[model samples]
Structures are given as structure tokens and as C-alpha cells.
Target chain A: MSVELIILIVVITALIFDFTNGFHDAANAMATCVATGAFKPKMAVLLAAIMNLIGAFLSTNVAKTISGGIVDDQLITPQTVFAALVGAILWNLLTWLFGLPSSSSHAIFGALIGAVLVQAGLIGIHFSTVASKILLPALVAPVVAGVASYLGTKIAYKGKHNLPKESKKRYRNAQRVSSLLVALSHGTSDGQKTMGIITLVLVAGTLQLGGDQMPWWGQAPGTGPHWWVILSAGIAIALGTYSGGWRIMRTMGKGMAEIEPPQGFAAETAGMSCILASSHLGFGLSTTHIVSGAIMGTGLARTPEEVRWNTAKRMLIAWGLTLPAAALVGGLAAWVAHFGSWGFLVVLAVLVIGSVTIKIVSSKNHVSHENVNDSHEVTVLAKAAISSVTETIPNPLAPALPEEIADHPLAASPLRLTGLKPRPKPKVPKKKKTPPKSKKKKQRKAAQQKAAVAKAQEHEAAREKAAKAKAAKEKAAATRAAKAAKAKEVNDA
Target chain B: MPSLIYAIDWMALLLVAAVSIAATVIIAALMSVSNYFFHPPKGEEKASQPRRILGFIFLGLMACVVAFGLYLMIPYFH
Candidate 1:
């Protein structure tokens, strides 16, 4: 009964891990497409979700192995698997909080290795598989994809000056297609991992207790995941993809490199092809690593300076730490669960508490689809500065600026936002002059005065013309009167 | 060292790399050629009818390759 309870926990945790896997890798497919404006942010995620749903039902071959036989499943119980999942989920959330695209597959593998170490000691792990399968592919796959994308981007830009609007539009359309393939490839690879884990847990539980008696839910070690498992895993992952990992999307799309439509098309094509080929060859390469490398390669092909090496370095560090960090946490979880059922409850408590804390911290620095396309580091820093400023210094002049500008994320300084402030009055003899205005106001006043002066001059000119005409008319009338008087006197004589 | 070497299938890895790079390069080249003829640079004569048809043919080929990639993903196809 205790073992069954553990198995239930393991299955639930596996599904949760699958959910994280979906969102964590959502950027791998849609980031380039969204960055290039081929699809709107919400629309891109929706398309990726639909493709992921279709791809999950495509195959169950990858579900056959958990860690490719790295951890000896017979030695470890479902409790160990539960601990491993806890570690992987925490790591996934941690990396997501930092907006780093690390591998969910590697995280699980690392956690399994850690849990195995705690349960069955060093003898339970296959070190060679770890090196060749995990480490080797991690190193090599990215390089291959990078080189391919570099070449592809070059080909895309050939005869490039003033690329026609029609051609650019076509490239965006091509980017959408290639991005869909990537999303499908991600679904086929990642969605199957949780199914694999859940199946392993069921098999391990049934075989350990029942021995030769085959249970309804449990199949042989080499058998496919059950239909219910497939449906649940597919739905969980599709829902997660629809949730849209905006933080990681922003990091991949705008942080590492700025992607143009043609470059995005090339990167998605190259990355998708690499992932498909590797998966076909039974190599478990990370979609995140391959796509990130392809984007960097494409950026370098066009303008090397645009690639943010700092962010890339940070991502590389996170990738390096993913396995070991997950291992540490998983090992700790296994250690706690080894104490008893109480320890298991304690582990569950830690997982929930840790997840909640990370969520709270992430909410404090929220990155939604609206601000996802903004330059990441600058926007984050600016937002941080503004929030701090707003807390510390109450901007007395905030009302003076436009309401929208004052409340903008990038508007850190009120002075900078409005660029208008009352100028300090210059000291002049009190009787000599009125108060000095701001430079802008002075310029406006000068313009107004110039218009007034021009109006006054026109008025004076019109008055002089009227007065001259009146004087000329009066002289004519007098002359007529004198002429009449002279004529009358001549007539009387 | 020997164990590590045995654990990896180097030939398969190299094959995957080669195939992916080749496919990407070919697709990119085909798309470029299609664009070059279909939507030529401004201040130049429009591509002739035969050239436009040739561009369409290249585009059709690219579409076929993408479809082939999709076909590879389907497990039943294997």
C-alpha cells in the first residue's frame, strides 16, 4: 500500500515535469517566429500548442527508456523516482525564473542519477552512458546546428541589398512552417519523456511487489506507455505550451540576438532539421541548446556584434549547472524520503514551498507577452530602477507629464519622461523685468511677440493709408467750393 | 576511455550532423534561388515567364522536402 502511494506520487510528479517541459521548451520553436513578427505572441504559442498535441500522439518509442539505462531501475523504488522529479521540477522553475533555456531532459537525467546515488550508491549508475549520451550530444549537437544555421543564414541573405517586400513576406511564411516543425519535434521528443517515466514507475511498482503476476496498468519493461498515459501527457503538455513561457521567450528571441525574418526562417529551418535528424538517429539532443546555437549562429552570420555574449555565457553556465544542481537537489530529496513516510511528506512540503516562492519572486518581475519583444536587459534594468525610484522618491512632478509616459515601464526618471520643468528664475532688478520663463516658454513667447509685432505694423500701415485718402478728399472738396465761389462772383459782375 | 568510446555511436552522430547541415543548406539555397527569380531586386527587369515558372518549381521542391521531414516524424511511416 505504501509502495502504491509512492507510485501515485511519482506519476503525478512526472506529469508536472512534463508540463514544465512543455513551457520551458515552448521558446525553442516559437521565439524566432514571434521575434520576426511572423506570428503574434498569443497566436504563435497557440499554434505551437496545437502542433505539440498532434506530435505527442505520433509515437511512443522514446517512452521505452528512462535515462537510456543510466539508473538501474531495479535497485531504486518509486520514491527515488519521485525525488528525482521533484529535483527536476524545481530546477526547471529556477531556470525559468532566470529566463534561461536549459534542457528538461538533462534535468531529469541528472536528478535520476542523484536519486540513484542515494538509493543504491555509485554502482547503480552507468557513467559511460552519462558521458556519451548526455555530455557528448550536449556538446556536439549545438555545434552542428550552429554551423548549419550559419550557412543557412548566409544563403538566405545572398544578393541581399534591398530584399523585396514580397521575398521578405515569403520568408516570414517559410519561418512559420519551419517553426511548426520545431514545435512538433519538441512535442515528439519531450512529451514522451514523462510518459516514459510514468510507465517506468508503474512497471517498477508492479514487478517489485507482484513479481510474475502482471497488473492491468503495468506492462513489461520494453512495452509502450498506456493509452491513458498518452492522452494525459499530451493534454498536460499542450496546456503548458499554451501557458506561454514569456520570460524564456524574451531571452531567446530578443536577449541573445535580434532576429530578422529571413534569419529567423533560416534558424528555425536549420534547428528543426538538426533536431529531426538527431532524433531519427536515436540521439537525445536538447531542442533548447540546438535552437539557441542556431539563433546565435544566424546572428553571427549577419552581424556578430549584435549577439549578446554575456547572456550566452550566462545560459552556458546555467546549462553546465543544470545536471549537477538537479542532482544535488534530487539527492537531498531522496535522503529526506529515505527516513520514512514522514520524510516523503517533508519532501513534498519542500517542493510546494520552493515552487510557491519562485512563483512569487517571478511575479514581482513580471514579463508578459506585451513587453516580451522589448530589449530584455535594458527593459528589466529600467523597470527595476523605476520601481525602486517610485518606492523611494515620490515624484512631485509626475502629474506634470502625460499619464501614459509617467506610468511607462521605461520611464525611470520623471525629468527624462517629460523633458519639461519650470526653469529657475534669473535674478534681475525687481522693477526692470517680469519673471523669466523656461527656455521653451520663452521661445513660445518670442514667437507670439513676433506675430503680435507683425500685426501691429500691418495695423499702422492700414491707418496711414486711410488718413492720407481722407486728407486728399477734404482738399478736393475745398478746391471745389472755392471754384464755385469764384464762378458766382464772375457771373454777378 | 575505451568504454566511453564504445558507449557512443560516432558514425550515427556524424551522419545526423551531415544530413541536417545538408538539408538546411539545400533548403536555404533553394529558397534564395526562388526569391531571386520570383521577386527580383527593384530597378531591374522583371523575371521572364519561364524563369518565374522555374522559381515555382524550386519552391515546390522545398515544400516537398519539408513534407518529407514531417513524414519522417510520423512513427507509422517508419
Candidate 2:
């Protein structure tokens, strides 16, 4: 492929990566708000999208260092960037499929390192930058944000066991405001990364074409990405945000903590503050890590048990794996794509196939705006339904009963209890096309049905007998009272 | 380990922690105080006009804080 064509492909790939980044991190800003019912799932994502778009337009400072100083700028090639994006995009899809909130930025850094390692060996990588920037911040950001959230939550619940209705509404309003800020901050920080990548590719392509001077648009690197670059990146991220990663939202919002309005307000404010402050201080922290930490802190503030440690552990594992996993993928893609245009095409094919497979697999147990609030595990309502159904109608036909649900009865027939249509008595089937296992199961079911019928008849007989005896005793009492009255009247005469 | 520590800007980390904590605590406290004024104990009579106004004042302060946050996010102002 021509240099311009390759550059164009890389630009498109970077935009695709930016889109994935948008959806993957949407949970960070809006999860708590959605969990607390401050915003409906659809409305929450929509508001977050708008805020991210606005936030993207608000700043360009972060776009200067494309890899955040992780890889050697001198060695980065358009082809390597393409491989890196493929790795990042695939990793993001993989994490999103499992509903884990992994860091999209770290994925990019890892991919860049991996691709560069293959392209130029160890010399192209900066080990110290990785250690100091990505690793340290990943470890520290969460803890700091968590502590702030904990203290804020404590203050929120101070001097009150149960907040009044009016107070909850007030907290809800505050939570909404905090959540919007988080979204805006997310947009500002993440929206520019794509712009930087695009700009980097453009500059590299122009130089490779033997241009002695910089393009009019790219004359000053510090001036940031071209106006169109910013616009396109902003739109791409916003659209991705609007798409809504309901799976990850469910995991973060409900899986981690049972967030109330007060806790939501606290966690969001804590996260937003940390993000804004850290970014301003020139050492950008992972927004995902900070928000996740804040959420856990709020959970702890309520009670230790309120925080789902198992879910937290799972998330921690995902965060730890994000870098290495993306790096591995990036390395493999780079190795394959190093062969030339055909090799790049092959890598692209694999990425597409992998993404489609993940998307298909995720659809099996769908989580959408309608069911986003439902916990991954069987929800309380579903559990209640199971109990009521099992208690009154513990028949074999009640679809696939678990072993834990035991039979219960309250003077009611299973038919009335379950509201299931009564099956016709199994007439001995003649010449039916039946599988052998199903036929045997059917025979067993028939036997059980006969026994249940017999039990019902016995119960009916006993009830009738008791009712007759009660009628006879009442008759005898009335006759005795009448005779006593007659005897008293005769004695008076 | 020492080099990693040296590489990190400790002042920035400290600033982040302090700013985040201070902002969180202040915002949460303001919201709580406003809620308290608007909704006192169950047995108490309805809050007087001045108390309600005080509650609004707290909420207004919260709005101001939010505005400051907006300003911080926008690099144009910075």
C-alpha cells in the first residue's frame, strides 16, 4: 500500500480505538449515578455523552505526548501504530465482553510498547517510564481516591441513621451534578488521545513523503491536533459513550457496591476531584482506577460486607492483566504485519473475527438498559418468585427446579398454586415418534402424576368427613337447647 | 525503587490527594448541611423562612463549587 493509504488506515484505526475507549470508560462517570437511580440508564449515558463531547472541546494539552512517553517517539511508525491499535481495540472488546472495567489508556500504552519491542527491540521501549507512570499511578490512584470517598461517605451519613425523603432528593441532585462533572473530565482527558495518535501518523507520513517543511495545519505540535482532528475525535468518543457499555455499567454500578444516593454523591465527587486535580498537576492518573477505588471506598464506609470483595478481586485481576494481555496481542499483530500489506490484512482479519465472536458471545446473556439494574446473579425478585413457586407448586413440571427449593403446601392444589395448565391424563401413547430417554422420562412423570392424584383424593375425602361431623354436632346442640326450654315452660304451668 | 520514587513528582501526588479530599469533604458537608436545614427531625415544626433560606444558601454554595469544577476542567480558562 502507498504511504498515504497506510497513514489513512492508521488514522481510521486510531479513531476506532478511540470509540472503544469511549464505551469502555463510560461506566467510570455514570455507574454510581445509574446505580443510585439518580439517572435512568439511557438518560445517564446520553448525558455522559454530551458532557464528554463538551469536555473534549475544552482542552488539548494532553494530546502532545501520544504514548504518554511510554515508547520512543523516534521509532514509532504508522504500521506499528496500526498494530498497536488493533491490540488495544481487541483487548477492550475482550474486557467489555466479560464486563470488566479495564483501563483503555493502559491498553494503548501496552500495545505501543509491544509493537515497538517487536519493531526495534528493547531500545524502542522505556522501562522506567512504564514503571513510574503507569504502574505507580495504577497502584496509588485508587487508594487515594478510595480514602477520599470513604471520608466523604462518612460525612454524608453522619448524625443520621435514615435520611429523610427531602434529604435523599437533595443528595440525588448533588450526585447528578458530580456524575456530570466526571463525564466532562473523562471527555477532556480521553478525547484528546485519539487526536494525538492521528496527528502523529500525519506528521510521520508527511516526513516520509520527503516534505522539507511542516504542513500548515501541523506546523506547531504544541498547538495540538488540527481542528478537524479534534472535531472527529470528539464526535467518535461521544458516539461511543452514547452506545452504552451496559455490561460493564452493571458490573461497576451494582456488582461492586449497593450505592445509595448519598454514597453515589460521595464516590462520584471523590473520583471527579481526584481526576481533575491529578490531570492539572501534570501526572494523569487512570480515571477508571480512581473511580473504581472511590466506589470501593464508599462501599467500605457503609460497611465492610457491603463491598463485594469477590467482584473487586475479579476487577483487580482484569486491571492487572490489561497491560500484559494487550501487549501480547500487539506483539503478535506486529510480528504478523511486519511481512507487509498482505500480513497487515491478515492481522486485520483476525481482529475483526475476534471482535465479532466476542460480540456474539456477549449477546447470549444480554444486559441492556431495560435489565441493566438486574444483578448478574439471580435477583431478589427472581429469588422471591422461585420461593413462592417452589413452596406452593413443587411439581416436576415447574421448569428446571434447583435442588435448594424444597416443597411447601398450604391447603391448595399445585394446579391453583402454579397457574400451570393442567395436563390431560397420559393416555397410553400409540405409535408416537418419541426419543427413548424422553419416553422413559414421560413414563416416570405419569407415575408421579398418578400418585399426586391419589393424594389429592385422600385429602378431599378427609375434608368431607370433617365437614359432616361438624354439621351433626351442631344439630344435636340445637335440639338439646329446645328441649330444655320446653321442660322449663311445663314446670311453670 | 528509589529511582521510581525519584521519578515521581511527590508534590503533585500530595496536591492531588489534598485537593480531592478537601473538595469531597467540603462538597459532601455542604450538601448534608443543606439537607439538614430543609429536613429537620420528624417532630420539629416546619422550618422557618430564614432557615429554609439558609438551606438554599448552602445549595447555592454547592452550585458555586460545581461551577469552579467546570472552570477547572476547561483549559481555555486555565
Two-chain DockQ for each candidate model: 0.76, 0.73
Which pairs clash inside model 1? none
Which model scores highest in TM-score?
1
The best candidate in terms of DockQ: 1
Fnat across every predicted model, in order:
0.82, 0.80
Each candidate: RMSD to true structure?
A: 9.2, 14.8
Across A1-493, the per-residue lDDT of candidate 2 in tens digits comes to 7887788788888888988999999999999888889999999999999999998888876555578678888888888899999999999998898888999999988888899999899998878789878998899889999999999999999945456677788889889989999999889888988888888788777777766666554334445577888898999999999989888898889888787899899999999889888887876789999999999999899866877898889889988998899999999999999999999889889988998898887776667787787664322212222222323444555454454543323223356345655444357858877679989999999999999999999999999999999989989888999998999999998
The lDDT per prediction is 0.85, 0.84
CA-RMSD of model 1:
9.2
Q: Write the per-residue lDDT of candidate 1 for residues B1-78, one digit (tens) a residue.
A: 998999899898889899889999999999998887787546766877887998899999999999899889888897
Tens digit per residue, CA lDDT, model 1, A53-168: 88899977755557677877566678888899999999999999889999988998899899999888899999998998889988987798899999999899883533567878
Chain B, candidate 1: TM-score: 0.85
Docking class of 1: medium
